[model samples]
Target: MKKNKIPYLLLMIVHLGLFVVTIIKKKDKKPLLLYYSGIGMAYVFEYVVLNIFRGYRYYPKVLKRNRLDSVFGAIVSQALIVPVSAIFITFFQLGWGWKIFFTLLYSGIEQLFIHLKVFKNRWWKTIYTLISLPFYFWLVSKWSIYLDQKPKKWIGYLTLFFTFWVNYLNINFVLVAFLKRIIFKKGWSLRKYYVNFIIAPIYGFIQSIIGVIVTLKNKKLIGLGLLHLVDQLFYRLKLIKMKKWSVYCFLPIHIVLLLVGSIFKQQMLHLMSESECSQRETKKIQSPI
Candidate 1:
């Protein structure tokens, strides 16, 4: 189905609005208010930019990263970048050209973490955040005088492109890996590959919202609720824990990857569809028991 645009746009506006509110009230200690808000806002923005706007491909696959560590890691990572990105974009008035360039550069630097095993090494994970930078700014820009008048219409397309890859990475990668960690901690005995590879995607989709809920209540069940029986198992097995405000890794890899991927996604999709159709007519696939 063709992607829906309105919900995505509305979500983006909401996220940017919240982000703005946080910036305005940066001086105030809101007691985990921003962190909780960021979780819902981030998911919405990430979903909208990568899934709703752009039609790039993201498989429903996840990696093997511990939920506890990834959550903390995300917090540490974002804390470092937020000030820098915010300062550059706002005080320095970095335009799209600079934004795009810095986004790619920063992403390449972060990708090192993936390779170094500081985080899971998924191909899409490394680039999608950079790709979203343009989209995020375009949303923010529309509310302010941040863009050139001639490029008005173009911003929507660009925002959409960035949104696709961002969703791909967040859904297809980051969220699943975190869920794997949580599952294992709960002592739900299972093969690692199945946990990280098969069950992870299904759980990842569920946990994406859980991560959002983690904000309202720092406990795992609060966000996702008691859907799975193993809730207490993970709750009991905590080697590490994050205080609700940590998971903000806003690096803008989406904008960078979107620019590159948009050029290729359509062609790739076309080729894949043709290849699949060619084999479908000859094959009556067996159902798995």
Candidate 2:
């Protein structure tokens, strides 16, 4: 409960409050998937602008001296708050007018944060946020609609990828950022946390992506072996510190990521099939002579 954290804490409360309300209102629909998707999508966007390009800085004061503190702040804004807001709008199907209002709302909050000194405006412009968020929210709305309907295969792929990305990022964050279980310093800039938290998760999912392709080709063993080899490569390069972690622990998790991805992909596809059946039933009823 540091004084500086109040801003982020308050924002988290407000955003999460809205999220809970949406959950209670639409609990049967299992809106959690869309929420996870929003976070995953935001992570990619944040990775590019915040981690890779250093577009901004955050000072949440949670980690205090470490760069992870700034990233924690970014996580609060990008991963938690923004995604929940996106879900709120999407679930409610807020109109274009509401979308414009939210665009302004987030833009205002950005400047307000800059003024409050919790956020740093580096290479990022509020104007960019102003321009990007409408499209972002619109895209998320389409994500919800796609999953609601007879979703296309590629949409299912992207949704599952993003969903799996959220899971992998959170678990890896707990192990690396919070618990300090292992370190990934091999090819990154001096063993930076971003290397593992951001880049490594993408590396992990690429394995899963390949797993999907290989499974389709009936080469599941090749996929599993590739996972093993990648894990070993990370360990052999001394990229990972084995004091509190090891390949024994990590390899299975990598395999599990692929499994979870595969399972969810099937679930979404089944949802599409169910939607198709429902639509056909309605059409049949309406076509009576």
Candidate 3:
């Protein structure tokens, strides 16, 4: 029993260490709410699907206390984004099926690269790029359709993109800076966050924006190639790491919030409509005088 416990404890420690390092290296914390919400919701759905819907015990199961970030995170790392993105698509009046399809597509491609050990092997990353060049072209097409509804106008598109980037940067910067200043007693500088914050997003956004532009232009191959190149570059530079958990953790909570907000919005609109109708009726009654 003691020996068996040792292995589990060691694994947990290693996982916790990885989690801590990942958190520390990350410059943003703003994504926390998004991340937690999405992943949490994913688990709830996965749970229902496996237990209630399918009538099967969740497979590939590990003991709860044995998990590093907690068993919940493990569940979330794989599933949270599904329902969350589904809700978002519903809110945006897009096809929920497409949204789910794209999310799964994105996750599959991302995981394939990670599991293939491409990141550690730069040559593999390059070779894989050349090999999958055509597929990614089709992949970005899906992304374009999925994201098209996000930005109504060019300005809105830019704004929405900028907002996402800012939010990502803010998550890392504020958390890191807070720790550095409060715990380390180090002075804060605006430039640190500004330059650092902009770098990753600029790289990622530019690459993705190009993919989107190319998809729009019907130059899918060229766009995907460029996107792949950017992905490789980021990986080679170690600028990006495949998030260990499923993006689901970030989605559910936010989806519920967005849905709740929309519900309130509908209520407000209905109330306003009623008020206007009452005013018109009142005017109609008094007009004879």
Candidate 4:
């Protein structure tokens, strides 16, 4: 076995042991959905930062040149690491001191991974991990408590928004850029501009409103829409240049993400309703009937 692989293998083993203990000992089932929600959100964040944004790389590369390796790696991290960490942080009822201790310990382990060449940082930094750990723990802790009381539709909405954003960034930015450069024999040009920057955002705005009709609909699309709009605006303002083919490339990718987002939104709603029903039924059964 490669030396770098040793750390990941050991971590996976420890994570599996922790999960087994959690299943055997955990009494409260309320946090289950919250755990899943955290995992989903974390996956989206990692996809955007590491895969789309090219913030870092895993040494030896998970799955070795497979295009889907990033997705696989994200799932693995969430499955083997995120849930266990969240569960322990929530379960232990640790004080601030212990929380800090665990945060530092986690950061230290990450540093060890860096030293072992398990991860190579580009735009990523250890301090960022140190800062984010506590926030993640606190977020999961609150989520566990909140889900026990009411079903928050906003959580589902946010998840959908992030999901769409992740797909949009990766497909439009990474995949398209790579294909255009290699296969099309195209170089980044100054004269071309992206039409999806205008069209998709408008489409997303209209679809998100007509479909969801929620207050957050506008809020969700605005930032993404503006990001796209601003890209075009930069070209118009002569602040940046783009290739003409860039617009064509962006259109289909945006269309795909929009379609996927629409389908995903419906599925999320159905799942949320079903979960809510199951929780209510459990409550009734446990009530003084």
Name the runs in model 3 displaced over 4 angstroms: 1-152, 155-203, 235-289
- The C-alpha lDDT values of all candidates are 0.38, 0.76, 0.37, 0.55
Of the candidates numbered 2 and 4, which has the greater lDDT value? 2
RMSD of each: 20.1, 2.8, 21.8, 8.7
> Between prediction 1 and prediction 3, which has the larger lDDT?
1
Which is the winner by lDDT between candidate 1 and candidate 2?
2
- Residue 24 local lDDT, model 1: 66
Off by over 4 Å in 4: 60-62, 66-72, 150-289
Compare candidates 3 and 4 on lDDT and give the better one.
4
Best by TM-score: 2
Summarize candidate 1's per-residue lDDT along 37-147 as a digit string, tens digits. 223234454344333333122211122234333433333333224323433353335677877776676667556544444444433464566766556544443422312
Could you give candidate 4's per-residue lDDT for residues 1-289 as a string of tens digits? 6665667777788878877676567644433444455665575566467645667666535454333343344455654587677776676666567667767987887787778777667888889878887887788777655444455767666555545543443343344234432111113443122332323333333433333333235343543454456445544554333444443344444445555656665555565666689888989999957
Q: Give the 10-residue window scoring lowest on summed lDDT in candidate 4.
A: 182-191
Candidate 1: stretches off by over 4 Å: 1-40, 43-65, 78-84, 123-127, 143-289
Residues 1-289 of candidate 2: C-alpha lDDT, one tens digit per residue: 7777898888898988898899999875557767777888888898889878888898778884356888788778878788888888888878999889989988998898889888888889999999999989998899888887756777767776676667766676667667788766656476477666556666657665765575445465677788777778778876665665667786677667667766666667667888789888889999975
How far residue 251's Cα lies from its native spot in candidate 2, in Å, is: 4.1
* Candidate 2 positional error at 99, Å: 1.3
TM-score of each: 0.32, 0.87, 0.23, 0.53
Top-down TM-score ranking: 2, 4, 1, 3
Cα displacement (angstroms), candidate 3, residue 113, comes to 36
**Residue-wise C-alpha lDDT for candidate 3, range 253-288, written one tens digit per residue:** 233333333343333334345555766778889995
